[model samples]
Target: MKRFSFIALAKLPIGLQWAVLAGGGGLAGYALHQTGLPAALLLGPLAVAICMGVAGTRIRVPRLMFRSGQGIVGLMVAKSVTLGVLLALSEDWYLMLLVTAITLLISAGVGLGLACFSSIPADASAWGTAPGAASAMIAMAEENGSDGRLVACMQYVRVVCVVMLGAWISHLFVGAGDTHLPPIAAELPFTWIGLGMSLAIAFLGALSGNLLPAGALLTTVILGSALQLTGWLDITLNGTLVTLAYGVIGSYIGLRFDRATVKHVARLIPVIVAANVVLILLCSALAWPLSYLFGKDFLSVFLATSPGGLDAMAIIAVETGSDASFVVALQTLRLIGVVLTGSFCAHLIMKWNARVSR
Candidate 1:
């Protein structure tokens, strides 16, 4: 079995190989999802990333793993923009605007905290640790002088913590009506053509060779979701695919934490962990008030407060049986908010850093 798996992995293109590993693990995860695996989502991505790290150390693959999983995020964001979701929010624009502002402020605060407390050079830590998109934050960190290792570690560690914690928090605060999330819709009976086409579009998106700075997974996620929404194509991304996405993302993150940064991480784990805890607590507290003000339920506030990316948060929202429309609505608004304000805040942190340096 090991030999066969190795041979299978060796025969595939580098990109597909990574995808298979990630996606394959996701599938395996899906199979066992019912068992309530701890950190089920992260397992696949970590596995693939570890494999890729081993392989890349041995032989380089140009834009292999990076491009393959990058687009998954964008595809996830597009899922939040169905016509119904758009129209409903159009009527509630004022409340969304408020929530967006609040979310941005909290994100900025957390970024600033990381800058001040950790040994991470302030600017890169601030931007790279920004908790929206890993690739986007890392790119911004690089451009802004953030340590990629610090930024990647901080961003992903927070993601892992936030997802697990968010769910626990939801359960914590759910009150009487809070219920465990329904099972994900099982993979629609398989069709080779459909699967091929779904992957084909993702591959084509990668082939576009555009450097979508935020990340290709997000780009492809957006494109693929758009296609799905428009009825031009349909994909029931199986657990394997989903797990693969998580694993690629997770492993990419773990690999980013080479020895030096790992050391920093160990020393600063308490600080980073505290930051995540504080952010989550504050966000959840803020969510309650906002939910009342917006005339939405607490879960909506929870979704808003939950700092996972639009895609990851959205999936959790859906998985936990939160109102899909509300989840999508809140996440979409937050995504737009982050894109517009994240850089400005990073700049602000940088300016502050320079002042301190002087």
Candidate 2:
């Protein structure tokens, strides 16, 4: 009977699929606000994700969800990058590099700690689950013969941690009441054009099949923003759309953890938990000092240091009064940097660690 109901639930249409995500997210957001825990906003998506995984695994749906979600996320990321961020580079490339390097070290430390404590191999575990860039990390891990299951586990674990922790931390500082919808109502006329352009860019980006980290969102957003900047498109990124995307991405990420994977590593839960704690602590420690040096708040610094999904961090940035532009800018830059340098770093680290172990 339980299985029957589960399967039945899984067969819902894509429209209904989105409804479930939105409804659940709103409810979660409301509850978090009531409790004065802004970051607890992730709870809704987390629950939805677990459900999506349980249901999605058993049923077939339009692959559109996966593709569209990817497209929108990538475009959003790409669009968010602007002349301002590029300008930041000219003023202080060294600071950006320093921050990026610190984050890499922290991300690496998480990978190393996981390998030492878990049954996972150092190289596989390290590259498989590093939180900085999922696409890059997964690719590198596969290239290097890392255990896929372990890599997936590590990646998802970090995702969960960052999502949950970021929300929690944000709520602690930014009052929950302040977490209402975006200023969409005030910018209604502007939004129509924005939506049109966003959709066009999203579709085109998806069709292009680029697999860069946050590829779809990055692509669409860039194209859309360019259109907007150039007066070619009149689009508005209302709060509703942002929230919708956030929930969708979070749910998609959460639903990816299937039963087989969970069962396979049930015993390693403690290690995953430990690794999460260590990584969070290490990132916080590193971010705190940098925050002081940069004259920014700790949360912004922490978000920059966070090895979670770029989308999630950006969302947190918007909610927590962090310099959303700066966070997005640096995070994107670091992601590109990670894509370029991560494999080499992993290679050297794995080799050195292997030599020491032997």
Candidate 3:
């Protein structure tokens, strides 16, 4: 029997190399899942990709792969958005809007402070800290003449921090230890037609997302929800597909963390981490009052208010048996709000930076 050789694989074409990396990442993610760590699939692939990236691996995940992953996650999230959830959200529209406004302000303030104090540009910092979809923000930052690479670093670092901290907090407060994982497709009542329709929606959503702001994931979620909420379709994705989505997303993000970025932001890492911690604490505090007003537990509100990846937060909500619908709704609302207003806010910060520099 011949032994497998990574060295030989590395000599292959970049596309094939990436495929191999993805397979290895999926296996690693599965192994990590066995350890009961929250978001293990995401964390494992992310860690592996980061290590490979830092080691100077030239394999790259295409933009399509990332967008598809976002679509899959978006569809998964949309499953939580029922008519009941919509009605509840309508009743608290004012409160949810207020919370979204406050969170945006906090993000803007942190970004401005970073721009004023650090060497990072104002536009990059603003979009990086906007609390919007990480991929969307990065793209917007680049389009607006900011350093997309640095913005990606800031956004993803905060994402990692928010996810890990949110998981720990949820575990501590909600005691998710006793809760079993949700059943996969085999146990669920799902049809091939439903799966086919869902895939069609995801593909069309990805194409439409090119025209919409933060479109890829948001579009998928909206389309999926529209179908499900209308009782026209019910789609249940299998555990394997969800895990694959996680692997692609995690690997895509992790591969962006190369040596040059790490070295460039060495001094700024501490400041960025500090800013993220302060933002989370401030948001958590603000969530307390809303929890009472909404008749939800503190943990649920905190996760809802958290500036993290939407899919990761939603997953935590489901696993912890918290209000998944509420969490997903608020997160989705805030994400859209931020994406819509991000450009104007970034302009303001840039102007402010100019004035302060004078």
Candidate 4:
């Protein structure tokens, strides 16, 4: 008998290998969902995929599928955008600027410390430690000549930590949290027209690769938000679509892992996790003052300022019954801030590192 079931199946046809992944991921996702963990479906597939990758699974998710998944997630997040959210952003532009600047500086400082003290490169460190849409950060990192695979790993670790902490805080403070989320399909079983439009838009967004890093995602978000605000677009993303997206993303990242990558990053994981924890704590601390100043509940504000991606934070916010709009607005604001500043920050850090070495 093979030492591991995965090892025994290593020589199977790639199609069968993928079948194994799908079966394992589905079972794991269902189990985790039943446990009510935050980002359960995504995390469950991720857990299995990581194990498969570590076992030297030869299959890899196609880049197109991964990009499509990103596009879908972008649309999902765009569903949160509304006219009132835009007005709120405009009204509190200065406050938004202040918090965004503070968050970036703190994150950059942490990245710099990690780069100076660790084996990771300066650009990779900056992108890895950045607080923004995790996928966006990873894409930008790759575009800027950083080790994107490592950045993806870093971002995932931070996301898991942030989600767990946010969920715990939400459950602890608010007994029987109050969520006002309407059913995704309160009107019909499903909107085929809406779903088709969404897919068409997402496919169009994926074509934005030449214009932007993570273009598939950001473009879809921008286009979807605009159309949604105009009442001309109906995004009909359901659990199955969402699960497929998550699976694609999870598998893509997981397949990037291998023995060499694992060994290279093994020692770095601990410090990377610590840095993420520190950033989360800092963001939470900022959230407290912002909560009082804005006359909002701490959970809402805390979630608003969290370092996780908009998708994961969205899950936590809905679960905790936090003020969904406020969280989305701030999260959207921060994502823009991070995306805008990501390249400049990486360049600055690289320069500093070069100077230090000389």
* Candidate that beats the other on lDDT, 2 or 3, i.e. the better one: 3
Instruction: List the candidates ranked by lDDT, beginning with the highest.
Output: 3, 4, 2, 1
In candidate 3, what are the lDDT values of residues 271-351, reduced to their tens digit?
A: 888878877788878877999898888878988999868767866676566777788778888888888899999999999
Measured against the true structure, the TM-scores of the candidates, in listed sequence, are 0.70, 0.83, 0.87, 0.82
Candidate whose lDDT is highest:
3
lDDT of candidate 4 over 235-354, digit per residue (tens): 786767777877776666566665557766888889888989988898889987998777778988898898865655665565455666677667777778888888998888888877
For model 2 the local lDDT of residue 48 reads 61
Instruction: Tell me model 1's lDDT, rounded to 2 decimals.
Output: 0.59
Output the lDDT of residue 68, model 2.
Answer: 64
Sum up the clashes in candidate 2: 25
Candidate 2 vs candidate 3: the TM-score winner is 3
Our model 3 lands, by Cα RMSD against the true structure, at: 3.5
Model 4 local distance difference test score: 0.75
- Shift of residue 235 alpha carbon in model 3, Å: 1.1
Write candidate 2's Cα lDDT for 1-358 as tens digits: 4555544556777677667666776687656657755444445776666765655444232334544655555444444445775565467667878877777777777677656656767777667545565655776778777777767777777777777887777777776676544433244465565677666676776665445666654566567657756767654556556555555666667766766777777788678767776777776687777887777788887887777677777666755557665676677777877777777877766776676578
Worst lDDT run of 10 residues, candidate 3, spans 176-185
Instruction: Superpose all Cα atoms of candidate 4 onto the true structure and report the RMSD in Å to 1 decimal.
Output: 3.5
